[model samples]
Target: MEYQYPFSYDWTTQEIIDVIKFFEAVETVYEKGMNRDEFMTFYRRFKEIVPSKAEEKKYCNEFADSSGYSPYHVVKKMKESNPGDFVKMES
Candidate 1:
């Protein structure tokens, strides 16, 4: 069985990077275009959100552009939170 959130198991550096990239993408979308300032802000916040360097990757493989975004896994995560923010709100 997999460990659930608020109780994440463990994380690795690669996982952290993957998530960071994900956020960067999201920021791009959120901004409605490429905004370096907004991206840096999101990136900084994302870094703060991750508990540690040995961090677990949430949204590990959900990016449509990336091959790693596993559909099953991404769907599961989508089912959890982010009720409307992802769609209702652009980016």
Candidate 2:
């Protein structure tokens, strides 16, 4: 990846790490595939850090702009899939 992960100055060190992990999971979905449960774990933690939909959109947009990976689409696929399904995307 040529770009840095989007992050907020207000986040703590651990929060930043968790947010990065969430982005990484998104990356995994596009590059290969990720387990629904594993991706959900990251997504849940991401929600904890960014509870507001507006704020979440801001972060996701920034990440997508830099990385060309859409977190929104990944989350959408995850929500649409059943348990034990893999989340995958093609860009």
Which candidate leads the pack in lDDT? 2
TM accuracy, model 2: 0.96
Error of 1 at 64 (Å): 6.1
Tell me each candidate's TM-score: 0.31, 0.96
For model 1, residues 1-91, the per-residue Cα lDDT tens digits are 1221122235466555645564545534434543334334444555565645444243433333353223233333334534233421232
Q: Stretches of candidate 1 above 4 Å error?
A: 1-32, 54-58, 62-91
Model 1 poorest 10 in a row by lDDT = 1-10
Question: lDDT per prediction?
Answer: 0.41, 0.94
Against the hidden true structure, what lDDT does model 2 obtain?
0.94
lDDT of 1: 0.41
lDDT by residue (4-91, candidate 2, tens digit) is 9988899999999999999999999999999999999999999999999999999999999999999999999999999899768988
Best by TM-score: 2
